[model samples]
Target: MANPEQRPIGDVSVPLNTGDVRGFKKEMGRLLEDPLGGAERLDQFLGLNIYTWVELPSILGILFTMEERDMIRHSGMRVWDRDSQGPDQGDQKWPMQDPGWNNQNERHRQNMSDLQWMIIRGIREAVPKGQNLGKAVSEHQGKDEALEDWLE
Candidate 1:
């Protein structure tokens, strides 16, 4: 039988690498301290690897609990900014105006969204039968707010 600690990505299953996950988490922590650099590092970390993309959500689920995943999403938002404008700077150069930068920014935004979806989906999949997933997450968060609140 396949080890429970191993997750399938693409055509193969491999055991999780603690060192790689630790490095990724370290980069995530840098997001708040350095937005542009952190984003660049995260993009480079993910690269163009199919295996990384396929395994990312599962790796994230293993590395963090639902609450921690939610926090990571929030931290990413603070850095990436949903609109892609990032933190406002009156006189600063607008990197998004460049076609290349704009494309990269959009890709990053999509990546973040995808990761968020995976986290929520994982949570939903873990919910007990007949139990409302939204309520369960809200309760875990210590609130009575709607699921959208958690999503946002």
Candidate 2:
């Protein structure tokens, strides 16, 4: 069996090595490009983390909610308007109104949305029937703590 500490990247499971950041990046890029196959790999990845690190599901859920709020805030603003009376005195466009900045923000929002959907899909597929990622992890932790208490 593979070591519990090793994380799967693509077809192989390996221990995380900060020195091989470039290699990890390359694999992630490849995974992102192939959605169908990537989903399966992502499921495995999330499953491993869900079981191995009890806090991960809650952390990811919080981060995902934060990203959704940020996206909503960005989308709610009218990005094409000028704030002429502001600090630039009409010499410079408002940062949010700048074409480049708006485009970049839109791209970032889209990327984050895609990533969030991918993670949600992966979790739905990876988790067993009648249980979500968060519930499963919480239940697992509860069982462990209960067992410990009983033992003590």
Using lDDT as the measure, the top candidate is: 1
- For each candidate, give its TM-score against the true structure: 0.31, 0.21
- Minimum summed lDDT over a 10-residue window in model 2 is located at 89-98
RMSD of each: 17.6, 20.0
The residue-by-residue lDDT of candidate 1 on 1-152, one tens digit each, is 88977954322234557688777866564322443444455555555432333355565565566665565545443333433453433112112122222213545444444444433333333323454445555554437877777665
Tens digits of per-residue lDDT for model 2, 54-91: 22223333323454433322332222122122232211
Which pairs clash in the backbone of model 2? Answer: none
Off-target runs (Cα >4 Å) in candidate 2 are 1-23, 30-32, 51-152
